[model samples]
Each structure stands twice: as structure tokens, then as C-alpha cells.
Target chain A: MNLTVERVSAGYGHVRVLDELSWRIPPGVTGLLGPNGAGKTTLLHLLAGITRPWQGAITARDGSASVLSTGKEYSRRVGFLPQHFTFAEEMRVLDTATYAAWVNGVPKRDCPAAAWAALEQVDLHSKSRDRVKSLSGGQRQRLGLATALAHEPDLLILDEPTVGLDPAQRLRLREAITSIGARRTVVISTHLIEDVTYMCDRVGVLAAGKMAFDDTIDELAKLVDEDAGHGFGSAFEQAYAGIVARLGREA
Target chain B: MTDTAREGHSVEQVLPRAPKSTAPRTGFFWPLGVWYFLAAFVVIAGVTLVRTSLELSFAYEEWAHTNGLFQRSALDITGPLAAAFGAYLSGRLTPPSRPYALPRFARSKAEFLAHHLLPAATVVTAGYVLGLVPIVVKTYSTATTGSLAPLGFVIGIVILNTLLVLGWLFGVVAQSAFAAPIAFAAGFAATLCGYGIGAWNSVTPVVGDVSTAGRVETLAFALFRGAFFAIVLVAALATAAGVLRTRGFQRRLPPVRVFAWWILPAVLLAVGMVRPPSPAVREVNPPKICKEAVGMSFCVHQAHERDLDDLVAEVEPIVVLVGQENLPFTRVEDTALHDGANPHLDPTVYYADVSPRYGATGDRDIIANLIAGSETCFVRPGWEQSAPGYNAFMLTLRLSGDRESGADKRFGKLSDKQVHQWLNSHRNQIRGCAITDDLLP
Candidate 1:
């Protein structure tokens, strides 16, 4: 799946998010990293077609003329887990998956099996019968991931899926993502430095709606050792501090 | 590859090996369809009961020929059943189908009417069929009664329920499933409103004279009370329909087929109206002659002429008036169904046409006059049809000299002294006597 963001400048009323930002997502895990208010969530939303750009456009591989949300082609193939999500408390874990299957029109016969398969992959098959209200915070997050995959979507976008999970749950989530990444493009946005080092194949450091660099984790480690007067931690911190200073000067 | 297989795995590959459990389609249809059927039946039955009850009354002919045994029992079961069906249908058929909330079914609307509005009428009609049981039991057999003025009573409720059911249907179709109850409430209110409108316009249609039934102003009361809410019922249905259409409820649930068992009876009744009234039968009304004490000078007279030959032969007789000096009969004015012997003396003419056993007629009026000085001396032509068993009395009147001339001539023929001897001898045959000069011309 080729997701091309072309010269897209979008913002909420009075506040800009993506300022003339453009990127092309090839078929692979592409991590988006940024500090607080760096427009990371906005960029993710724009890419997911949940929010539209105020200016410019987005197009998939067919090069069809882009209109935000009018084309649900991406939505059909792309699975999205929002930063903040809530489910009906009375609904069982299995039911959450069943509902998504119905909404996506998977017919009646295959829904139950497909839902079970997704739960199994997410390592939550044992707890599928439990109501959502009874699940732990970590279990709920895993259940959300199972629902997103119930339809066998090709592009999975998880927004801070591990936000509140304990270390063990986060490790399990990371492992599941890594396993799924072999066939599907699983993109996740996170703030933890170790998550990037341990899980991501490549990372993009975005600051103030601008990409500082997009490269392999190896390249980032080598660059820090060879050139920065600042330490690795300071160098990573300066990456955002330097861009905001320059953007402010430019304004 | 065929598109079917390409879209997903073939059906063969996906089947879960589970056996089918009866047809789901029919399963859904019966539970849902039965509700609609019952609801429709209730609507029709309720209106029929109320209308039938109001048309029935306490008439002597009605009492004689038919004890009302069948109608009494039939109404008892049908009345409450109809109401229950209405309430059940409204509650079961529709519930909330909003995006998030759970649905709610309705219970009852207008606690005031309940079974009484409709069932009470039915109870009266089926009275005789149940048993002679009692007079009260026979009259109030849930079926319509003459005393109730059922035409307006029934029309009023039909208009009310129609407005409600249709209006609620409109809500279901137009808005979310939640608005169904409003339609029902509107229906109950609509009936009352029609009554009120009928009352205000004095458009109430009454089939008989009610003065003798003792309830005053039956027509005016029925009109204002009946029509007030009829318009309301119609308006409610119209409003609900308009609202429902806009909301697109037709797209969601199955269409409701309105089939009511009550419709059969109602249609039969409607057709019965055009079937030509059954030939009038002389269902007799027993004579009301008060007893008198011997040697009373100041006696109250309340009796009519009786054909002596027909009476001795056991042929049902006609009563004739006795001049003063005839054995005098004095009536207690307080008897039920009696108009005092002298309503005319008070300037308010009453009991000339009140209810009777067969219908409204001269017999009730005669009884009215005896109890009071009202017009009881004559029966108008075709008057036997109203008081059926009074054919002999009417035949006697038809043969009598011009009514205006007869009263004065008969009085003049009897002199005070000469009439006294004739009256004193026929004390058993003549209820009233005394050859008093003031008793006649």
C-alpha cells in the first residue's frame, strides 16, 4: 500500500499541524516520533484519512484524485486504533471483534471464526468470553488490537497502543506487532526511546511539523558516536530543540 | 475465477458443520405477525363494544322477547380481551431502535377508560345469552345498550384509537422507535376529544327518545361528549403519519398488516344497518294501573281504557280511561320509569316519549301520563313500532273518532250523576272512578 501525503498543510481552527509536510509510506513499518505538540497525532490522523488537510491532497497507489474521507478505500484496507478508545462495557471481547466484522460486512458465516483467529493472534483467545468491563487496562488494549485485525486489514495504524500497559504487557504487544509486521505494514506512534531502539526497523524524528531525519536505528547510533558534542540523550533532545528554534527564527 | 470464490473462500470451505435449526424467517414472522393481528383485533373490538352498548336500553318488549342471555356473557370475555390485545400489541410491536439506547415497550394509556370504555359496553349486549341472571346483569352485558347512545360513544372511541394507532405508526416510521407511546396516549385522548367536539356541535346521533329512560338531554350530552375528541383522534393519526414518513421507518422494520377480528363484527353491523329493520313484533309491555281504596272521595286517577271482551277472553287488552266516580286509582309518583301523573300541570311536558321495552313509544308516554297529567290518551300512527306489543292500544286509537273531538265528546256523554253509577259497578274493569263533574267535560 502506497500512502502519499503531498504538500499537505492542515490545521484545526487557528492552529497549524502539518505545515507543508509531505511523505510517502512504502509497504513496511514506518514509525513517527516527535515530542509534545510536535503534530505527531495530527500527522497520523491525516495519514489515516480521519482528518483532512486544509490544503493539498493525499492519494493511494492508483493515483486517484484525493478527497479526504470521501474515499473509504483506505479505511477498508487500513485498520486504525485511536490514541483514546472506549468500548461498550457490557460487550464481550469476542463481541467487540464480531461487531467490527459486521460493520465491515464480512457476511455471517466467517465472522465468528475470523474473530477467533484475530483473538488468537493477539494472545487473548482465552479471555474472549469475558465482558469488556471486566478486562484489565492492558487486556482491553490487546482486545482493541484483535478487533482492528479481525477483518485482515493490510495497513494497521496503532496510536500509542502501549500507552498505559505495564512492562510485561508492552513486551507482549511489541512481540505481536513484530510477528505481524512480516506480512502487513504495522505503523505505531510512540514516545519511548527504547521502544524505537528495540522494536522499530527505522524511525523518523519529527519536530515542529518537520522531519529531522528518517533512517535506520544503526545509523542513528553511529551518528551520535561520531559527531555530536552532546551525549546521545542530549543529542536526541537537541534534535527537537534545534528545529523549533530555527522555525521560530524563520517565522 | 468466478467472483464468488474470489471475494472470499468458497461457501463449502466456510460452513461450520452446524445443522440448521428450523427456518429463521418463519420464526421471526409469527412472533411479530401475531402481535399485529392481536393489536388490530383489539382496535376494532373495542369500538364495536362501546357502540353496541350505548344503543341498548331497558325496553319492555326487549325484556319480553329476549332476556339478553347470549349478549351478556359474550361481552364479558370479548371486552377485556379486546383491551388486553390493544395494550399488548402496542407494547410488543415496537421498541426503541436508536443507535445506543435499549428499547422500551409500552404498558397502558389512559387509565380512565380501561375495560369500562369498551368492555362495559360488551357486557351489556351478551347479557341474555348468559342467563336471565338478573335485570341489571342482562342490561349491562358489555354489548351496546339503548340507554348509552352507542352511536356517538363508539364513533368517539374509534376515532380516538385510530388517531393513536395511526399516529404511533407514523412515529415509528418517521422518527426512532421511541415515539410509539406518544401515539397511543394521543389515541386515548382523541376519543375524549371527539366526544367533546360532538358535544359542542350537538352532532350526536341518537336512535331513540331518552326522556323516559330518565337521563335528561341524552342527545346534547352525547353530541358534545362524543364529538369533542373524534377530531383529535384523526388529527393525531395524521400528525403521526406525517412525522413517520419523514423519518423513513418503512426502510427498517416489516410493514404492519392491520387485520382485526373485530372488523368482522363491525362490518356485519354496518351491513345490518342496510338490511332493512326487522319487522316490528308486538313484544308486549305490561300495563301499569295503580290500586285504589274503597270510598275515597279525593282520589288520584291514573288508568286507561280496557276492551272488556278482549280482556275476559284472555286476549291482551287495551286500557281505557275512567271518568270520575269510577273506582279511583292513585299512583305513587316516585316509582321508577314513571313520569308523574301531571307533568303537563307543571308546564314541563315530559314522559310523552321516553324509552320503553320495545323502543320509544306511546305506552311509555301513557305510563308517563298516568303517573302525571301528560299526553297519554293517544298513540300516533305507526306508534306500535316503537312500543311493539301495543298494537291493540294503537288499533283502538286508529279506530277512535278524531282524537281532538273524541276526548271532549266522551267527556260530555258522561254526566256526573249518570257516570257515577256506571263507574261504581265496573271497579275491577275500570281502575279510576268517580262521576265528578271536573273529571271531564
Candidate 2:
């Protein structure tokens, strides 16, 4: 399945967060990398249909599956992990994940399997009996991820997935996502270039509610390598600086 | 050629760190033992309250009251479980929370609101149906005269429905201070409906010399009592509803379903039951209305009871007791002969309690006549003393009218002495004796 976002625009109240932004994600790991206010999260929201774009259309489709026109249709094949992890702290991990599976319309026959698989996927199967509030931040974040994946969506959209995770936890997630990512599409949004280099196939850098650039990791490397000696981090800094300086010049 | 496309494409593939979506909830875990125990305690408390307070028969207690928050009482024990369910099903349920963005299928707000209000309407409609007891009664009584039309039933239904809805809404939002006023008004409507309909038929004309105004006064009394009973019942159910709403279903409490609905009808039923009858009031050892002329104290049964001859014999002196409907006049007559007074005695007449005067014609028939007669000076408040003065005034008027007709006093001048002399000649039926005792209702 692929998602097509054509010329979309959206905002919070009077201030527009997305200004006629548009892009597409075919089935694979596509990374959205941007500075904090670059609207990376906003783009994910628009594609997911949580925030309706003021000026464009988003359509998602898969072969042998219904084309999704709205959220109800979109969520069937797509799963999203919002940057804000609002775990019902009062809820226990296993029960919470199980209910999410049920709510997402997993077949009754498949529900137990989905719950077990998701808990095991997050490495929280040991704490399945524990209340969410008892979990550490990284575990909670992983728990959030597992809940989203439990329904087995074709497309997984995560905003800041490795946020608040230590290197070890991050490494564990990288392995888990790599395995889950074989056939399903995964879009990870983050500013960390290291994550994009290791995890993303096609990377889009969003700046000022616009898609500043869209290219594969190899192609992005080439853009940074235009200046031969600079490293990846220095190249990322240069690319971000170039966009900001250009905006200042235009303004 | 360089190994097709590069040094980075070595032995192993590095994985991407993508975030997973949030799951609904983990699998069901047994709730804390303490909570389970608390639920059981509350359920037991509720069942006991209902049973002891009502003293109902054992067979009716059944599973509803007996389950006591034990596993038997509930399918599952999770406080606020439904709201969590709502949040969980937030994805696929009809009338969704908000629109989904892209690939995920989620419900819209319109869909959720429709589902939410359906059960609310059904509950209110059911309560409204129960509140229609008054209108149904209006249908059966002969006092209403004509066959109540379909329109009347419809109007009653509308009014009762409005009251029931307000009562329910008032409860759901009980936390708001504004709900108190709605609750009070609903209570007033309840009283007017619950007791006013049936009881109004009996107390309409009023027992004393109060006016059609008196009927209004009595109605206001009923409204006060009715409002009190109604408010208590509705408020209780409303509290229960509020608890359920916040707690997500009070996992331990057996489903009361529409507790307020049932309780309101029970209150109405009680109001109907304990009210003093239309013409019969049972008072606690009230002074007997009958007094033997032999100077003995006696009481007649409450309204619609009389021992006439016994009354005459006991009050050989009283001659008139303003309201004598309670005195066993027939028995008083028998007792009077035993006391050796003339069998033919000038009877006492009461402007009050005229329902007995028009006996067998029924209270409904004499409503107008009783209302008119009861308003006279002798019966009105403070008029017990003023009655003699009015009688003197009427006597003066009679003498003066006759003086002009007799052609001696021209048109005006008949002194008080002449009026007195004329009154002695044309005095009222049994009016010669001064009124000794002014009795009360």
C-alpha cells in the first residue's frame, strides 16, 4: 500500500502548521527528518488523517485492499505512534495492549496472538502484569510502539520513536523495527541523522512546513558529500544552515 | 568493476529505529484485591439498604439484591471500564471520536454522538412512561365527566416526558450548582403530577369555608409534599447515575438500570396510598364530634360518620355544633329520646362539612353548593365572633324593610330596639338562643 498526500495544508487555530505540504510514501521505511518546528509531526498527522489539511487530499491504497479516504479507512492499514505517549497510566501493560488490539478490529480469533506478539515485540512480556506507571520511560515508549503494531497494519508511522531512549534501548528497537520492517512500510520521523542513516531508506527533510528535500539515504549522502571532506553530522548542519540562510535571504 | 554500488554494502544490514503505535491496553489482569473487596462491600451495602428499608418479601430479593458485588453480581469488575472501552474502541466504533488522517480507519464524532444519545433517550422515555400514572387515573374516574380524548393523553405524555427528561438531566449534571434549581422545579412538577391528580379530585371543594381559593391552598400544600418526596427519589437516582458516569459503571454495583425511574413510581404510589380519603379523614383520638345533651363528652368517627341522636343527647345544651358531619346524628337521636327531650328537636346546621347535608348526592355533586355556603360570615376565619353581629345587622335590615311596607316608619327610621322586637317575632330557624360554643373543623 502507498499513501499519496497531494498539496496538503493545515494549521492549529490561526497559525498554519502545514503550508500546502505534500509527499508520498510507498511501502518501505521512509524517514521524515526536520528541525523541531519543521512540521515533521504535522506531516505524519496529515498523512494519518488526524489533522485535515486545509488545502489538499490524502489517499492511501493497497492492492487487493480498500482505498482509504478518511481516518476510519486509513487506520485499518496504517498505525501511528504520536510523539506524545499518553499511556493510561492506571492501566496494566498487557490489558492495555490487548484492548488496543480488540479496538483496532483484530479478529477475535487473532486477538490473543496479537497481544502476545506485541508484548513480546516490545520486550515488555515480562512486565505484562505491571501497571504502566511502573515502567521506565524507554520501556513505556517501547510499549507504546508495540501497542500500535499489535493490529499488524501495513504502514507504521512513528514520530520520535527513539525519543528518551538510551543507546541500548535504541539499539534493541532498531533490531525490532528492522525485522518488522521487511514487508510493511515504516515512516520514522526524527531530527537525528544517525537514526536516518541506519533506519531510513528514503529521507525527507521538512523545513517551515515545506518539504525542503526528498532523497534516498545514498542520494542525501551525495548532497552532503558535495563538499568532499565534511562528515555526515557536519553535512547535516550545513544542509540545515543552508535552508535557514536561504529563507532569510528570501524574506 | 568496484563491487556494484559500494563499501557501505558489506556483510550485515543495520536496522531502523522506528516507533511502534500505542496499543489499546495489555491483556486483562485481575484487578487489585482491595478494589474487588470494596466493590463487594458496596454491593452488599446497597442490597441490604434496599431490602431492610423496604421490608419486601424474600422471593422478590432475587439475584439483583443478593449478588452483593461478588463475581455472581457482575460480568466483570473494572471501575470506569466503559469509558476505557470507549477510548479503546475509539478506532473502529460507529460515531467515531474524530476523523482519521490516512491509512487508519477511525470513526467520526457524529457517529459516536448518535450511539451515545440512543440509550439516554430510551431510559428517559421509560421514566416518562412511569410518570404517566396521573393521566391514566384521570381516564378512569367518573369525576372527569367526558371520556378523556386522545389529545389529553398526548398532552399528558408530553408534560410527563419533559419532567422526566429534566429530572434525568438535572441528575447527570448534579455537580453543577445550576442543577439544584432544575431539581427543585422537577420536584414541583413531580408533586403536582404524583399526588395532585388523584388527591385533587377528593379535596377540590375543601372541608371548611375556604374558597375555590382554599382548593388552591390545598393544592399548594400537596405540591410542597409532593415536591419533597419527588426530589428525594430523583436526587438519589441522580446521584447513582453520577457515580456510574464518573466511575465508569461502579464495577461492583449491580446494574440498577433505571433506579430513579422505579423509585419515583414508588413514591407516587405511596403518596396515593397514605392520603386522607376524599370524605374520610382518620385523626388520632380527636375530641368526639358528638356530645350527649346530658352534658357528657363524646367523639364521632372521622368524616362521613355521625351519631345524630347521641350527639343531641350529649349536647343537650350545644343545640348547634358548626360542623356536625362526624357526630353520629342517628345515634344522637336515639340517645336524645333516652334523655327525654322532645323527639322533634331544632337541628344544628353547619355551613362547614356540607358534604353530609347533600348525602348520597356525593361530594362531586355538591361542590358548588358547598363552596357557596361555606363562604358565609359564620364560617369564615374570625367570623365565629362576627356572626352574631352579622345576624343583628340582617335583623335590622328586615325590620326596616317591613316598617316601610307597613306604612308607619316612612322609609328609614326603625331603631335597634324595634329591630330587636321584630327579630324576636321573625327570628331564624332556632336562632333565638345565643351561640354558646363555636366549634372547629
Candidate 3:
């Protein structure tokens, strides 16, 4: 997926969040690292075509010039896992996945197999029939992941995907993302530097709705090397801190 | 790829897999708990109210004959209440504070409304039908006494259910736990106040008349009430659908667009209130049906055509007694159906305005009034006009007539010819109460 966002600006009422922000997401695992209230979720929402940008456009030039419009056709190509997501508690895990696929324009004849396979990827295959409310916190998160992947979207965006997961659950989710990364673009937005170090090939850091750094993981590591006095905490955190320091000084 | 190639392509390869199970689960996806509750409440409450009303009046025979129960019970709070509850719960299916799921299944505002609104409307309509079960059952078993006004009943039901749907639509628009009660209140208020005001007083919430079974006003009221409700319901639903489709609440539609919807119903109500349709007047020519009976020609309206022969037979004896004395009026006409609207104004013709049970009994006041010319002015029991001399004349006639088992003693004392001569001379006093006369010689 070759997705281009051109100078998109959005806000709620008088409080501006994303202002003339632009980025291009290539086919790989990309991580968007930002602190709370850094407009990471809003960016993901814009990409998922849930909210309209006040200015500028987001477009995907794949086989067709499919613009990110607020409609079913646009939604079908993009799968989004919101920062805070929930489904009907009475809905079974498999049914939840199936519903997601069905809404994404998957035919009924294909929904079962697609839902089942999505569940397998998320390692919730054994509990497909269990009610979503009955699941553990980690399992519920995994169920959301399975639903997002049910339609095999070209661009899969997960906002704070590992916010409430245990280490083991986080590891399981990382494996699923790593496995799916080759065929489509996976965008994960979170505050944790470790998530970027563990899962992503490319990383972008946002500070106050503006991009502080956008490069490969190795290029981000170069920032840590330039700040030699930042004594080896995690190299990733050191790099993140250096970028934040540089942006702060410039502001 | 060929159709078969596409059909056979494994979606499993693209998605994850579930663990082995003996059977794949498949059943209905419709959520039913709140829906069932709403349907049951509407049906039970509506039917119970109708049944209780019929029992209280001992009017089921009449109700069943004219489909009066259905007419009166067609529009009520039950349907609106159920719709509000069901719609409020449906929003819980995908809470609005959170993202809505059905939008994923739809592309536009119209499509979105179709996807979600259809199910809600279906549940409400089903509730309406279930509520009508009692009336429908009663109708099938009971024989119709006169020509049935079924069109009125149908219009009533349609208007009622439309209001219920409007209630549901409002709940959908509100999209909160409190939405149900708020929607119910608004709906109940609109209908209750509509009826409370004189403008729609004749229209029942169930969509027809609440009283009087046999009059043409019942049908006229149904059509008028139905039209008004139908127009209002459309406006409400249109606004509701528009609100639901909007991405956020508190956003206002353009002023001109608001006018687009509000104007139609407002104008319709204005026109209806300004010039309501009068009840259709069906003039039944009484003179055409006049039949000679008991020294006078008696005629009744077409509705009471069947009772004419029996009525003629019932009055012939009284006429014979009257002819034995002297007579003034030669015609005794019944104006029951018209409720005295079309009375023979000729003083020579005696007319009785009283309701009666068919094949049972005629009003005794008519027979006495024929001799006494006393009009039964229906008023509150406390405000009755007392014509003492006329009352005395009726008492004299009844005592001396075959109604009592005594001899005509007043006539016996005075010879029959002499008694007749005295009464004829004193006819002015008896008929007009213009003068006082001695009761006893």
C-alpha cells in the first residue's frame, strides 16, 4: 500500500489537534510513537477515514486512485483498531470477527473461513465460540486484532495496540504483526519506544502534533549516538529523548 | 478468474484459523431480548385496555359488530412506549458514544437509515399487529349488526403504528439510555394533547372515535385524524432520520431545510383546523318509505328500515286508542338515526327522537307525546323542564288505556260520546298546555 497524506488539518471545536500534517506510509511495519494527547489516535482516525480533515487530503494510489472518503468503499480497504475499542459483550469471538468481515463487504459464504483464519493469526482460535466479555483483558485485545484483520485490509492501523497487554500477550501480538507485515502496511501508534524497537521497521516520532523524527530504526539509532551523554538507558529511549530535546530547542 | 475459481478460493489462507470443532456454529444474528419485551408490552397493554373498556360498557356486542374495539384500541401509548424502549435498546447494540457498526454496512444517509431503521420499524409493526389480536378475534366470532365500517378501523391502525414508528425513530435519534422515556413522553404528549385539544378530540390515539358506534361521524373522524397524524409522523421521521445520519448531535440543519419539513405539516394542520371536513350527510327520504299504519303514516330512516314493520305493529294499538278520541296529527314518524336532525316540522305530524334496541321495545314517551305533544328535551337530569299539565295528560291516557288493567272509569262515568266531546274541546289545553283544565269532572 502506497498511502499519501497531504497537509491534513483537523480539530475538535476550537482546539486544534493535527495542523497541516503530512506523511507517506510505505508497505512495511511503521510505528508512530507519541505521548498521550500528541494526536496519534486522531491521525490514525484520519487514515481510517472515520473523521474528515479540515484541510488537505489522504489518498491511496494502489490499483485505483482510492481517496480516503467517509464511505463503505473507502472503509473496506482500511482496517482500524481504535485506541479504545469494544464490541457487544454478548457477541462470541468468532461472531465478532465474522461481523467485522461482513461489514467490510465480505460475502457470507466467505466470512466464516476468513473469520476463523483471522482468529488463528491472533492465537484466539481455541476460544472462537467464547463470549467476548468472558475473555481476559489480553484476549479481548486479541479479539479486536482478529476483527481488524478479518477483511485482510491493505492498510491496517492499530492505535495503542499494546496499551493494556501483558508481556506474553504483547509478544503474541508482535508475532502476528511480524507475520503479516510482508503482504501489507501495518501502522502501530503508541507511546512506548520498546514497541518500536520490538516490532517496527520504520519509526516516526510526534511531539505536539508535529513530526520530530521520521526515518528507519537504524537512522533513529544515529540520533542516540549523537547524544553520547545520554547514558545507555535503552538506545531507543535515548534516541526518542534526543529527538524530543532537539525539537524543544528549535521551538 | 472464473466464478468457480473465485468461489473455490480459500479465504482461510488469507485469514487466521480457529481450533478444530466438531460442528461450525450458525444461527440467527438478531438480538431479541429488548425487542421481545417491547412487543409484549405493547400487545398486552393495548388488548387489556380494550377488553376492560368493552367489559365496563357491556358494549362488546356493539364493538365487535362495528369493529369499534379495534378503532378505539388502534392508537395508544403501548405502541409508542414499546417503540421507544426498543429503539433505545437498539442504540445499545452499537452505542453512539462509541463508534456505530452499521455505518460500515451502509454507504450513505439513506442506506444507513435503511440498514438500522428497517429492523426497528419491523419490531414496532409486529407489536402493533400482536396488540390487535384481541379485537381481531372478537370480530371474527361476532356477527355484524349493521353495515361494518372497516375502512375506519384500518385507517386507525395505520395512523397508530405510524406514530409508534415515529417514536422509535426519535429514540434512534436521541441515542441514549434515557432516550426511550423521553421519546415516549414526546410521543404520548403529541397524541394526548392532540386529542385533548378540540381540534383532534374526535380522533382516538388508536386512530378513531372513542364514543358512539353507529354514526357517520366515527368514519369522518377516523379519516381526519389519520390524515393529521400521518402528516405529522412523516415530518417527525424525516427529522429523525436526518439527525441519525449526521456525524454529531447539536449540529443544526440550515434554516431553509428546517422550513422544508416543518411547513407541510404546519400548513396541513392549519388548513384542517381552519376548515375541517364536515361529516357526510346521507339524506334518507322518509316520505318514500311512509307506510299507512294505525290511522297515520309512519316512516323511519333507511338504517332503521328493518324495524319499520315491527315499529308499525307496536304503535297500532295506541293509535286505535287515540282514534277512539279525537286526533290532530295523522303521522307518527321516528327520527332515531338522524338523532332528531331531520324531523317532520309539520305540527300535524308527531315525531319521536329516542334510541331503541331493535325488535325489543319502542319509546313509551313517543306514544304519550303523540297525544300530549310533549317534546323530550334531553338535558342534564337536574335541568329538566317541568310541564305539569302535559305530565297529567300522559298519566290520564296511560291509566285509561290498555297499558293498565282497569276499566276506563272516567269514560264510564261520563258516556263515551260525552267524554270524546269534552276532550276535543279541551284539545288546545292538552296539546299545547296553553290553559289549565280540571283533571277530574
Best by TM-score: 3
lDDT of each: 0.44, 0.45, 0.61
Flag the better candidate by DockQ, 2 or 3. 3
- By TM-score rank, best first, the candidates go 3, 2, 1
Considering lDDT, where higher is better, how would the candidates rank from best to worst? 3, 2, 1
Residue B72 miss distance in model 1 (angstroms): 26
Candidate 2, B-chain TM: 0.26
Candidate 2 structure lDDT: 0.45
DockQ of 3: 0.24
Better of 1 and 3 by lDDT: 3
Task: Please provide, for model 3 over A159-200, each residue's C-alpha lDDT reduced to its tens digit, 9 standing for 90 to 100.
Answer: 888988899988888888777777788889987788888889
How do the residues B333-393 of candidate 1 rate in per-residue lDDT, one tens digit apiece?
2121233323433222122222233232233234323322212322345533432213223
Tens-digit per-residue lDDT, A95-187, candidate 2: 556545545555433444566676777677778778878998788877877777766666788888887789988887777776667667888
In candidate 1, the second chain superimposes onto the true chain B with a TM-score of: 0.32
